[model samples]
Structures are given as C-alpha cells and as structure tokens.
Target: MTIQNRERFLNNVAQHLGRERKTKNVERPSSSLMPQWQVFQHHSQDELADELELQCHSIHTTCKRTNAENLHTVLQETIEELKGQRIIASDDSRNETFGISSLYEDLQKKGITCHIWNSADGQYNLDYAESADVGITFSDITLAESGTVTLFNNSGNGRAISLLPRSYIAIIPKSTLVPRMTQAAKHIHEAEQEGHGVASCVSFITGPSNSADIEMNLIVGVHGPVEVTYILVENR
Candidate 1:
C-alpha cells in the first residue's frame, strides 16, 4: 500500500527470482566444459560373455560353460543328480510351465510321484511344499556377474514354488543372463515403460538360502532351499 512497502516487496521478489535461477544453474552441469572420458565397449557378444563368465567364475565355481548344443545334456545331468538324491517333485500345471513338463514326464517314466497342479488352483498348500523335496521353476533372466537367477512371482508361477521348496532348480536361457544388474534393471524399467506393470515380485537368487544365526554355526536350508542348481540354456 505504501511507497516504502512496495519498494521492499519488489526487491524481495527480485532477490527470490535471482536465487531460483542460481539454484538451477548450480544443479545443471555445463556439457561444453565437462571433461570427456573414454569408455571401453566390447564389440561382440562372445567378448562380453567371456568377461561376464570370468566375473561369475570368481563367485561360483560350479557354473558350467556350454553352448546351445549341450543345453539338453546339462538339464539331464541336473535332473539325474536330483533323482539320485530322490529330492525332485515336478509341478506341471501348464504345459508351458518352463521346462517342468519334460522334467515331469522324465520323472514319471522312472516311477517318481511328480504331480501337476493348475495355476488357477487356489493358493499352494504349505504341507505339499514341506513334504516335497525340490521345486522347479523358469527364470525370466539370469545374471552372469553374480550367477543370479531372476524369477517373476506372478500368475503363471507363484512365489512359493521357488521359496517353499527345500531345493530349487531353475532353467534360464544364457542369452537372458545379462552382464550386470544395471542392464537388468534397464530391461525391467523399459518393460514397465511399455505398459507392462512393474512385476509384483522380482527375486534375485544367487545361491541356496543359508544362515549362521545360531551359535555362529552355519546352517543351510534353514529358511529356504538348501541347494540351488541352475540349468543355463544357451541361445539356440
């Protein structure tokens, strides 16, 4: 209302505007003045895979190396190991339930009691899981750097199938096993952007669930699977 008050108000507004401009400038980096850095990029997929394989070997020694030709053999061997121990229960609800159908048939031929349950069926019975030896599931992706398998907990395959069982055997295509987590996150993010809703559950399993909580003694299979074997299928 008064001349002095009007002057003060105008000065305050000018000061606030200046501060806002300065804040934005401080937050933004000057592209022209920024230093350029070199990033070594691999040219071929084999080169990338080799690099990732080395990194993965450092973490897991059991990680098998194979091409598309031997993927079936690898799966067969893994199945044999489970059968020898008598710890495999194939859940073949849908014929499209990853590699379970084949596994189920193989076990059935051998007189193993592998049951098929429908996906539409109600929540999984805990007793079945408790009595079961191992659960088999398909992974959406695998990470070579950490030897991790990524599973989506959705309608096709419930989360309990992987968690409740004492042992989990995952079939993951080698092409899906990325070099790093950032790449994996980018893929998921892009999928979400394309209107596929964020996955209800994204589990990254590197190894069997274990804990050394009691008296500093290590115990496996205390919470989840005691053994986790991954059958990596290369691109065919």
Candidate 2:
C-alpha cells in the first residue's frame, strides 16, 4: 500500500481501538477492535504429527519421526540416502539444547565435508549455501496444518542453508509442533518476548521448492532445494 494510504488506515484503526496513532516509523501493535471468534483450537500431539507428515508427503517431501535417542542414527541414514560428499550445517544453540551437539563431528567422521553456517558473525568462509549438496538445520517451530517448518535467521541460522541446497534436512523436536500457523506464530512471538528477539528473517517452508510453467511442466529445485526432509525427534 502507499505510505499515505497506510498511515491513514492505521490512524483510523488506532482511533477506533482507542489507541494513539504513531507519528514515527516505529511499528505499532495492532488492536483487536472487533471481538475475535473462536476459530481454531489446539490439536492433540498425535493429530498434529500425523497431519504434518501427511501434508508433507502429499507434496513429495519426506518427514521421518524417530526417538530422540536414535536421532544421530536417523540423521546418518538420511545423509547416506542422499549420498552427498559435502554438507553444510547450522551451528545453532538449539542443536545442543535439544541434545544432539555432535552432528558436525559425526559428519566429519563419516568423511563428509561439513561447513558450519555463521553468517551472522561474518564467518562467511563457506560462502553461499548453494554450493553444498545438503543443508542441515534445526526447526524452532513446525506447523502441522501446512507441514511447514520455521527457520529463524541469525549468525548460526542462514536462510540459504535451507533454500540453496539440493536437499535440506531439519531436526524438529516434537514439543515444538503446533496444529496450525496461528499457534506457531504465537509461539514465536512468545519466545521473542522471553528474549529470543524476533527473528530478522522467519521462513515458513513447506516441502521443497517447486514451480510449474504455463505448459504445466513441473520443475523442482528451480530456485531452492529439490528435496526437503524433516526428522522429527519424538522424545523431545
């Protein structure tokens, strides 16, 4: 929208909600003038998990669920299936917080060249994430309704790590799974309130990158990963 139109709209909304319109460029909290109806409710853990996998599979993406203890094994198997020589991985603290800190070491032991993404701190030695065959990262939240995984961009989390690779692997903890996008957004906002700070770049990725031409010919990985895998850690 045009700046003038947006400002006028915002002022109207603010006045209707008994709020003062902002005169600066700062973001203002949106008010709910009209009462919100009960539109969505939380789903059971089992339901969310099932729905997430179903949605992912429908789009040709693979979602694997395994016990937390067997995560290392499942991760290794996924890499083996890809048979890629070079892999780029995230060094996000969530890896250790979820109890799988040796992922990088494991990759190195397997003779696969591994690069840790540290773009936030200017450690861009690995350059663009597109050069790697597979990119690995952790998910802070997963929305079951659309089978989407949320990636927070920071020093350790790079957007390209998930989008530029031929294949993307995400380690998702079950506790972070939500029934829909609204709940996922609430969780991210709450986390930010507790000091996670809003992610500068929050991505909701569903399956891999795909596009169809006017001729109806489908092309995968034209702009992003051809294959996306979600390894759900059930015990978490």
Candidate 3:
C-alpha cells in the first residue's frame, strides 16, 4: 500500500522468481525402465540370443534358445517340465511363424490338450487361458537389452493368453530382436504406416509380475503370470 512497502513486495517477487529458476536439477542419464539412450545391438544372432537369455535370467525369467526346426521339440520339453497337460496358444496364420497353427497337432499327439485362441471363441479363450497350465504366444518385438517382449492385443492375438495364465511362454524370432527400444518403435511405426492396425492394448512384459510395496516384502505373480519363459528361435 505504501511506496516503500510496494518496493519491498516487488523485490520479494523478483527473488522468488530467481529461486524458482535455480531449483531445476541437471537431467540424469536414461534408465532401463524408460531408456533414452541408444540400445546396444548384438554382433551376431548367437550373441543376441545369449544376451537375451542372460538378461532374462537376471530378471527371474526362464529363457531358452532353439532353432526354428526344433522349436516343437523344445516347446514340448518346456511344457513337460511344467507338468502342463492343458495349454492355450495363439494361432499365427503364417506357417513359419512360431505360433504356427499346426502346433495343435504336435501337442495333441503328446496327449496335451491345446486350445488355439480365436476371436470367434471370445470368452471361451479367456476362460481356457485362465485355467490352462501354461499359455503360449509370439512376440512382435523382442528387446535384448532388457529381455522384454512386446505383445499387441488383437481379435486374434488375445491379451488373456499372456496375462491370465499362471505360466507364460513367448516365442520370439531372432529377426525381431532389436538392440534398443527405439528401433523396435521405428519398426512398429513403419508397420502401422503399411496398414497394420495398431491395437488398443500393447503390453511389454519383462518378467513375471512382482511387487515389493508392502513393508518392502517381495511378492511375485500378484497381478499376472506367476512365471514366464522365453523361447528364442533362430529361424522364426
């Protein structure tokens, strides 16, 4: 109100503005969760697969490397290891894809009940995946740096296959492996440009669901799959 008081108020405002500008801290380097740095690519396919396996183990996920030709054998072994008699799988139209439609035949021969998810089946697939000993799906993008698999939910590619089952097995082809997240993003973006419909839900799963929130106690499989396994195929 007074001249001197007004001058003091203006000075106080100026000081407050200066302090606000000074409060910003230096930006830190990119982290694993939302990395900003370039993803490191493997020198060879073998190197990439090895790196992915090691990283997956570090995160408590089981990972195995196998050839496309022997993927069926490897998959059977994995299912046997889990004592899984009932399995749910995603159906891939491409015969060469890891989620090939004929996998049903092989599982059936082994006396393992396998259900291939279909949009027409709707809730039946969800219910099957929920109680199935394990659920199988293929990944669109695989990140070796973080051992992460990205699954796009669609009418055919049900999210329940990967999210509802107690054990999840993702089949990833070596060609899908990218050194970093940016490369994977670029690939997905390009695919979208060429008429690939981006789905409503995209899930990037690193490992089994875990939380350490309550009293800093460790808990696993609270929200999603209790265990996760990755099968990296060379010819996928």
Candidate 4:
C-alpha cells in the first residue's frame, strides 16, 4: 500500500475511535515485574536441552541429541524409521554445515528421492512439498520450555517446506536453545538493534498440528504435519 493511502486509512480509523492519528513511533512501556525473564534463565545449555526433551514428550514430538560426528547417522536412521520416500528440505546453508548436504546425496544414491527448496522454481516447490513424506530444516531458535522450534521464513525457506509435509524435522543447534519465547524475542530484538537483517516472517512450531474446536474435540494433523521431530546437535 502507498504511504498516503495508509496514512489516510489510519486517520479515518483514528476519527472513528475519537483519538488523534499517531504520526510517530512511541517507546514500548516497561514493567518491573517480569517473571518471564526469570524462568530457566540460569540453566546451562545441557539443562536447556534436557528441558527441551521433557517438553517434547508432553507434546508428542520426538527429540534426539547427537554430536556433529554422528548427526549424519542419527538423521539417516530417523528417516529410515519414518520410511520416507520423498523428502523436501529447505535451501539452508546450515544443512551443509551440519553434513546434511552430503547425506542428501547419499540418500538419493540409496533410491530415496530428495528435493532441496529452490525459490526460482516457484509453484513447483509447493507441489512437491505437498506430496513430500518429510520436510527438514534448521531451527533459528529453539524454546526449551515449550518444545518449540522457530523458523525464520524467506524465499529459500518457504512456509510450505514446514507446513505441507506429512512429517517435519527440525535440526536444532545447541546454541540456539533458549529458556522460552521471552529469550527468543530478546534475541531477535537485539539483532534488530544491531542493524542485522531478520526475516519478516517467523514461525514458532511446538509440535504436530492439532486443534481443539469449539466443542473441545481434539483433531491432529488438521492444518500441518502429523509428526514432528527435533534433532539437537552441538554446533561448536
């Protein structure tokens, strides 16, 4: 939308609400009582990983820990256990750092079809992801308290790569593990303050998709992947 049009729309809304149009950004208010900042704040990385696993169990998602040396084996075993035939992975460079690039080549040699996300391909990415047995991507930040993995979306990391697949796998670096959403938000905010570029869209996925409707009927896999797994690896 054009700036003029947006301003006019805001003015109209302000008129209806009996308030002046806000022309300048305001500083966010601060609270003295921030219990969120204290929860698990002092936990070590190992402790955070343990709490992450505990939360994963409650959410019905599998969490595994492996070092860089054994990540390839653990990933391969997980895919074999899932019986994945067609896999879709994000075009993320971290996959290479974690040895997943070579692993994909090996999987293809073993007759498992694999596709890495290509933004240029456009709609084909979506079509393939819809039929993919599994989707794999690296987590930007992981919340230990809720078993959540944060994905910052971009052209290379499309939303469909995580949302459309039958199953999803998040490769979590130990350094990315945080106490909760509060820490995650702080990291992003700090990045912004440091003039770092951040993705416009961020996804916080806790577990397999499930919903409880008005009548409290629980349904799983309604809007996204039926199964989700987290593979935690020590990055350093």
**2 against 3, candidate with superior lDDT:** 3
Q: Per-prediction TM-score, please?
A: 0.67, 0.79, 0.78, 0.88
Sort every candidate by TM-score, greatest first.
Answer: 4, 2, 3, 1
TM-score attained by model 4: 0.88
Off by over 4 Å in 3: 1-37, 41-43, 94-100
What 10-residue stretch in candidate 2 is worst by lDDT?
A: 33-42
Full-model lDDT, candidate 4: 0.92
Model 2: lDDT to the true structure? 0.79
lDDT of 3 at 128: 92
Question: Rank order by lDDT, top first?
Answer: 4, 3, 2, 1
Q: lDDT of all the models against the reference?
A: 0.60, 0.79, 0.80, 0.92
Give the worst 10-residue stretch by lDDT in candidate 4: 1-10
Off by over 4 Å in 2: 1-42, 120-128, 192-196
Q: Candidate 1 regions off by >4 Å?
A: 1-61, 65-70, 84-100, 213-218
- Give the clashing pairs for model 4: none
**Per-residue lDDT of candidate 3, residues 158-220 (tens digit):** 888888888999988888787767777887888889997887778888888889999998788
| Shift in Å, residue 222, candidate 1 | 2.7
Residue pairs that clash (backbone atoms under 3 angstroms), model 1:
none
After TM-score superposition, the amount by which residue 126's alpha carbon in candidate 3 deviates from its true location, in angstroms, is: 1.2
